[model samples]
Target chain A: MDKNINVLIVDDYRTMLRIIRNLLKQLDFNNVDEATDGQEALAKLRAGNFGLVISDWNMAPMTGLDLLKEVRADARLKNLPFIMITAESKTENVVAAKQAGVSNYIVKPFNAETLKEKIEKVMVHA
Target chain B: MPDGAQAGPDEDRIEAAVRAVLVSMSGDLTAKEAALLAELEALGRTIARAKAEIAQLSVDDITGAHIPSATDELDAIVDHTAQATNEILDACETLEKLEAEVPPAAAEALQGAVTRIYEACSFQDITGQRISKVVSALKAIESRVEAAVANASGRPAPAPAAAAPVAPKTEGQELANGPQLPGGGTSQEEIDRLLASFD
Candidate 1:
C-alpha cells in the first residue's frame, strides 16, 4: 500500500516542492504529482484519482486549512488522507485542524525521515 | 457548728431576696455588655467591608478607563514610529538607487562625447584627403604648363619632374607659398555636395 500510493504534493515554493517530491520518491512512492496552491491542487484532485495529499499550510488564494475543510466536506474526497505541513505551532490551530478532520500534522523544516514517519503514521491509521 | 447552723424563715427569705437581686443585676449588666460589644464588632466589620468594596470598585474603574487609553496611546506611538521608520527607509532606498543610477548616466554621456570627437576626427581625415588630392592635381597642371612653354621655345625640355614632392617646409616658406591648394582645389560646394551624398 505504501509503495503503490498516489501522492499529490502541494506547495508554492518550487524548491520545497521538488524536495518533497524527491523525498516521497525515495520512500518508494513513485506515483506523484505537484500543484502550487490549494485551488490548483483541488482541480488536479478532482481531475484525477489521488490516494493521499501532502500540503503546505500558507499559500495564496486558498490556504491548506481551507483545503482540508473542503476535502473533508466533499462526499467523494472525505475518506482521502490529508497531511498538513506548516511552520505554525499554535495549539488552537492544531485543534481546529483536528476538528476539520485532518489525517495528521507535521511542522515545517522537516527532513525526509520526519516525512516518512508522518506518512507511515497516517497511512497506518488510514 | 450549732451557731452557724441556727437559721429561720425570715433569714432564709432575706438571703434568697439578696441572691435574686444580685443575679438579676449581673444578668442585666452582662446582657447589655454583650449586646453593645456585638453591635460594635458588627459595625467595625461593616465599615471594613465597605472600605474594601470602595477600594475594589475604584481599582476596577481606573483600570477599565485608564488601561485602554494607555494601550491606545502606546499603539498609536508604535504605529507612528513604524510609519516614520518606513518613510526613512523608503527615502534611503531612493537615495541609494539615485546614487547607483548617476555614475552610469555620467559614463554614458562621457562615452557619447568621446564618440563625437572620434567622428569629428574622421571627418577631418576625409577633408585632409580631399585637399591633398586637389594639391597633387594642381602640381601636375603646373608641371604640364612649364613643359609646354619649354617645348615651344625649341630648347631641350627641362628635366622631367617626378611625382609631386611632399617636403616639410619652414613657417616662412609656408607663408610665402600662400595656402598651397591641393591640385589647385575643387570648390567648397562640390566637397559639401560629396559629403551630403554620403549622408
Candidate 2:
C-alpha cells in the first residue's frame, strides 16, 4: 500500500471529516480530500483519481449505500477500494455494504489503530 | 234494551276502560319518540362540531411552526457539537506536532493522549447521526399530522414538501438506519464475524 495514495473522506459532519483526515495524517497518508455529502463525493470520485473512499453511511440526498451502488455499477470506479466508516452497525447495514463490494467497515468511536488496520487491510487487498 | 240484544253495563264499562288505556299508551310512545329524535339530533351536531374544531386546529402550528422549530434545534445541536469537536481536534493536532520535539517519554505520553482525544471526538459523528435520525423522525411525524389535518378538513393531503428527504427505493436502501443506542446495536466483533461469513 502506497502511503501517498490519495484518500477521499465523505461525511456530512465537519468534525468527523477533520478527525479522519488527522488520523490519516498520523498513518502517514498525507494526500486527503473531504466531501460533505455523497453527491459531492461522487462528483469528486468521478473527476479525480481517488485511490480510496471512506464514507459515512447516513447522509442526505444520496446516502453512502447509494453512492456505493453507483460506484459498483460504474465500470471505471468499480474496482476502487471503498471502506464504510459509520455508526450504522446494524447487521443489515454490514451485509448491504458487503454486498455492495465494500472492502472494509469501521464502527464509530473507533480509535486510530482500528482505522489504520482497516485501511491497511483494504489497501492490501485492493 | 232492544229485543234480542243483550248489552250489559259491565261489558260496556270494560270496553271503555280498555279504550282509555290504549289511548294513554299511544300518547306516551309518541312523546318518547320525540325525545329520542331530539337526543339523536343533538349527538349529530356534537360530532360535527368536534370535527370542525379538529380541522381548525392550526395545521400551520404543528406541521409548520413546531416541527421545524424542533428540527432546527437539533440541527443547531449538531452544529455546536461539531464546532466543539473541531476545537478539540485542533488542540490534539497541535499537541501531536509538538510531541516530536519533546523527550521520548513525554512524546510517548503526548501521543497517547492525542490518540484518546481523537477517539473521544468520534462522539460528534455518533451524536450527529443520532440527531439526523431525530430530524427524520420529526419529518415523519410532520407528514402524519399533515395527512390527519387534510383528512379532517375533507381535503386530499398535499404532496410532500420538495425538500423532504427522498424515500428509500430499495430494501438495501431502507436498511441504512443510523447509529443505534447503547445495547441496541451489533458490536464490532460481530460485524467482523458477519463479514467473514461473506467471504
Q: Which model scores highest in DockQ?
A: 2
Cα TM-score of candidate 1: 0.39
Candidate 1 chain B: 10-residue stretch with minimal lDDT: B171-180
Indicate the DockQ of the complex predicted as candidate 2.
0.58
Give the candidate number with the greatest TM-score: 2
lDDT of 2 by residue, B1-199 (tens): 2222222344345445544554454434577776755554454445445556656878899987999999999999988888888888878888998987999999988888888788888998888778888898999888877776676567777886578775646544577777788988888889888999988
Off by over 4 Å in 1: B1-199
Q: Give the TM-score of candidate 2.
A: 0.76
Interface RMSD of each: 41.7, 1.5
The list of candidate 2 runs beyond 4 A from truth reads A74-76, B1-53, B56-59, B153-172
TM-score of each: 0.39, 0.76
lDDT of 1: 0.57
Best by lDDT: 2
lDDT per residue, candidate 2, A1-126, as tens digits? 898889999998888888888888878899999998788999999999989999988787788988898899989999999999888888888888999888888888788888888998889988
Candidate 1: tens digits of C-alpha lDDT, residues A84-104: 865434444555666777777
